[model samples]
Target: MSFAKVFRTRSFRDVRQALLEREEIALVDVREEDPHARSHPLFAANLPLSRLELDAPVRLPRLAVPIVVFDDGEGLAERAAERLEELGYTHVTLLEGGLQGWRDAGGELFKDVNVPSKAFGELVESERHTPSMPPSQVQALLDREANVVVLDARRYDEYHTMNIPGSISVPGAELVLRARQIAPDPATRIIVNCAGRTRGIIGAQSLINAGVPNPVAALRNGTMGWTLAGQALAHGSSRRFDPHVDDHVRLVSADAARNVANRARVGRTSRDEARRWAGEAVRTVYRFDVRTPEEYEAGHVPGFRSAPGGQLVQETDMFAPVRGARVILADNDGVRANMTASWLAQMNIEVYVVDGLMPADFAEKSSGPSARHAPTPPAVDELTPTELRTLLQSPGTAVLDFTTSANYVEHHIPGAWFVIRSNLEQALLKLPAAQRYVLTCGSSLLARFAAPEVVALTGKPVQVLSGGTNAWIDADLPLEIGETRMASPRIDRYRRPYEGTDNAREAMNAYLEWEYGLVAQLGRDGTHGFHVI
Candidate 1:
């Protein structure tokens, strides 16, 4: 019998009550991104079964924390629970009826990814009446060369892809820290924008909260609104705020940010207290270095993961899935952590900013991927890139790519079939009969875990590409592009209408309409424990 049969289950009411009462619970959606986005409870975090081992240890830290896993109808919930059990999770339970159960029980299901953070952004705008300027108005000012500065409150990559002409990248949490320097003149008009709405409103409000002496407004609906108004966006713009800040500006920014955090009842803890909290087996504590990725890779605290402040606020559910868990944020500068904690506190999360840490304290350093606590993968036969290339020439040999659909479409070994690890059984039935099989993904870490399972299913010779697709690329081998051979549907990632430049006008308009109604939906759902100050 499967271990899933032995596991207990929680009804929708039980999970909802836990969230309403602010009790600790991780209502995890174990399906891939597309399915989860189509329908799911408001607070459910998407932790796909394919990447569970890679993310679970970091997102859901405590083994004893109550966890309720679910899937729409793909039979992934039980498998996910079993995997969690094998990973030593003590309190794993399946959602009684999965997604269907929630719907039948009158639970509100949300569409799109990052629902909590996006909904919170809408709520913030409703409550604060965050000021905004339409794209045309901002464009007029820019065209006339008025005393206005456009600050793009998105990740650097997002900003580089497309941005308002003459705008500088000042990602969300950095607004308060860097805004003064970018527009030192107090009378200059400051406009913030994101791909859609969340970061723009949050960034503009952050400057207001920090008591910056400038007029501020968000670019309404961000680049989407700009596009709707038939405005052209500058591509490949690389303008950014200077990292260096004067001592006076840093001190003022720190004081103002701390004041906002204090108003929101965000706590401050010493490193010792934070360490104690992390050591508690009963409590789930997430330690994050809310600094830029480049800075984090240079040096950071020993246990803290790199979660840039802007993205953390934009996707809180992704970083800390277990609702009501303790979250501790760190940064060498005093501004970023406190500013980020203020937002988390208003979102009803128990958050803290670490105090009394100097540059010397960030002793631990890494120049590679963040450390992950995945289970030891089963040993499998390995093949070098040259060997795989030689093997591909032989008949009756098949190569399966287990990377994301997006990556597979971008580039892969010639004639490789794209497959989803969770649906491998069905995927294999679509492939031609082969005497041997080979598995590979981005870095071979995921492929290593799937090799044993494939070997068991195929009952044939199986091997993994030594370094996965990256190694093949390094070998300068010929590659193919597009969805040439797809064994499974490309449902691993949901294409957000707000990302990239080629979005349809209808989809972009519909996305804005959805955001407009989020506040009303929040009221209807009644489970978000938010308290905006």
Candidate 2:
């Protein structure tokens, strides 16, 4: 069927009108992050085809919510709409001209992921005049051996990748809880940084807002600025916050953070309240355990998914795709949830922290049953590694690798054709007809998710390679490198302009210029109800 006949389309004007009226509409970009990051509407959520099953149920819980899907002419919107319909969504439409149509209609396009949240951060800085120190001044402090401590507010992996010299991995919400532990001497200066500006500003502000005693300032423009100033950055650093603390101290800190959250008008709810919210069919509620991955894996609330407080604030759009949904954060360490909730409240989300769960309720269940929302694998044939090897050498059999594009580029089973599961049907049309098909990913769970889809499309017996490529490697099988075989374009992930070591100077500068103008754009967009408290 033609897209024109099957799907309704909203013009850029219609979308803009909906936004201006503050109607609940999800302007979703069906393209992957890389293309979506290049340009999208201010409120456009990147619900890439690859992650629709895993993310859409949580992001858009209301089946009847108005949703408009678009692509950069990649022929993905219609497919995405189809998937949404299969997922029981009732109101789905396509953007009239996709991305280009929005451009032709003079709708503003934003670059980078999390544009709405990041722009709100910029507005926060402008309104509150968040204090910051230039790279040169911070460098002077390091050279002088002054009583100064630098805290990297990004994820630990990001800090380990690259960081300011002498910075410890503090992450986002941890700043308020652990600042004093690192800087016992009240006179010591505290500098917070991320790869770019938002987390740094928010981290520093979090400390200031929580009334930390030590002087706190963001490393202006963060690591990007540090690089622009020609300062050396430490790589593979192991400096991190001490995990141990007195119970009394943690209780006191939690109390203080709760006070800050209360002042900011952030709400609190009991676990019972969260249960009631979960049952509300009219609204979507996300129950997230705002603790470290280690902590969560060790033991978390039964129904809560792991979304570390720091990363949750950094990537809210990716975590909770729906704009007007209620979020209930869970953490055994109360300080993290309170601090995280404070920021979300400022972002105009109706956020609350679960406050009444007992210590026993958070017991360790490292390897237990899956969470309530875990996807059920479609019933399909399974093949062990040894069996799959024999089939791969057969005349009419093929193997599809469903791993990330980067991982596929690095290594995969020899002769395995890399393919995105979402585009499996279209991708299969170009491949040679096979009597049987085998699907494999890192752990084979994702392979199971795609197995039934491929079966329905090709009318072939699809088998998942049990234990995936990892099992193949364990058996000492040969692996291929580079893009040896690709059935789909590499558009699964976005490369950040400010991340890593080798960004072009012009792109970095252009990125900064774009950030500087976001507050103005927010004013014009008028859709985001962001406010600085």
Candidate 3:
């Protein structure tokens, strides 16, 4: 059969109708993060062409699941669709007319990533009227040493970077499980804050939903509000919630969280049942251990990947791009998984919690990174760090760094030029002609995949740097920092207003204003299946 006959094209209306009906579908944008963030369908998850081979299996678990790939005139969708088919995908289609078709059909293209989760947060605040306190009131309470405990509902790294005075890092899903211990006094006011609004609102509401005794309120606009009010944030704060909860507290928290989950209509499944679902050929089931990364690394179920509950909720599209697929969360303590599942349930996902698991059930233990599945890279000649250094001294030898723009700016080989993997053809044309080329990314995994492509493009002696740039760093080799030599534009990452410490005041205000209007936008789009209990 011809390629066109095997892989058909899907129109914007067809994709939107499928989403509205909650049918299984993966609407993917094949561009890099920066372009994808500039505009895309509300549910379009970014699976960039550069890392598609590495992330496809994990993000889209079912090979036969329907997938519609699109690109905004970058000429990447058809190539991506072909790659998916090469990777054994049975059902892959191109989006008709690419991203422009969606615009022509009057589809709403959302800005920034994680639109669904952020929009859901806005909806919850709109419907439940989740209580919030502006920065001024919170500051006034803190000045007088009021009976309050501040909890930062962001990752530890973000908390360490900048935080409210005397705030403890409790993250989003951790709030319900750790609130009582952090503020044992029922009279103590509990305030939740993130860099911005979403996590703050969700964390405060999570505590309230779990029936915590203490009064809770979101720090309105989060740390952004604090900063805009001329309040100085404490940097390098180390305070964090203790993970070791008492047995009685664990049981109580688990009961409360489970009750919340039940109210949200989340399902419960046994380990055996979850395995059965995973083994089914017709369905896609993602098994995740929804615990802190440290805890997950120490011990976890064999097949479950580590997905911290807070991040999973905040970045659901990135974690599970196949909308309407079944998600099974495994948490030994029970509170985190149940609470996280409650939010996912309301997000119109078919989510379940693994019931009745003992500590012994988590037999697999690892202190390293989680396992990822990808096609074996084509064999290419590799030059060790020392050998590459020697080769660079000679003429007609060039190095291409396929790492992220952020990483390239931070540190890279002394003379290596930054290049985007998907845009290699154009980038190579920009570089001076060389007799031989060397490819390296942060870990060389991407470089290995790009070696054959480089050979096919230039017919040159293309080789990968052994162990990648990281190995060079480990070898005490000199490195370069900043955008020194760029063969391609740095469009791999999208800088968010909430990230980093030096964001302009105007940008921060604009981000909060954008979030405020998400509820209305969600209504106009009319595809999200979110609800509030």
lDDT of 3 by residue, 1-533 (tens): 65543459999999989998888999999999999988999999999999888889779888899999999987898889999998888899999888999999999889999989999999999999999999999999999999998999898999999999999998888888898888889999999999999899899999999999998999999999899999999999999888789888888999999999999999999998998888887988889898888888888887788888998999999999998799999998889999999999999999999998999988888653332445778899998999999998988999999999999999999989999999999999888989999999999999999999999999999989999999999999999999888998988899999888899999999999999999999988999989999
TM-score of 1: 0.98
Q: What are the root-mean-square deviations of the candidates from the true structure over C-alphas?
A: 1.3, 2.9, 1.8
| Model 3 misplacement above 4 A | 1-7, 367-373
Candidate 2, 355: how far from true, in Å? 2.4
Candidate with more favorable, higher TM-score: 2 or 3: 3
Q: Give the TM-score of candidate 3.
A: 0.97
In order, the Cα lDDT scores of the candidates are 0.92, 0.85, 0.91
lDDT measured at residue 166 in model 1 versus the true structure, 0 to 100: 90
Strongest candidate by TM-score:
1
- Summed backbone clashes in each candidate are 0, 0, 0
Q: What are the models' TM-scores?
A: 0.98, 0.91, 0.97
Per-residue CA lDDT of candidate 1, range 1-533, in tens?
63436679999989989998889999999999998898889999999998888878878878898999999888899999999988889999999988999999999989999999999999999999999999999999999999999999999999999999999998888899999888899999999999999999999999998999999999999999999999999999999889899888999999999999999999989888998888888888999898888888889987788898999999998989999899999998789999999999999999999999988879888653343455787788999999999988889889999999999999999989999999999999999999999889989889998888888899999999999999999999999999999999999999999899999999999999999998999999999988778
Q: What ranking of all candidate models by lDDT puts the best one first?
A: 1, 3, 2
For candidate 3, which ten residues in a row score worst on lDDT?
366-375
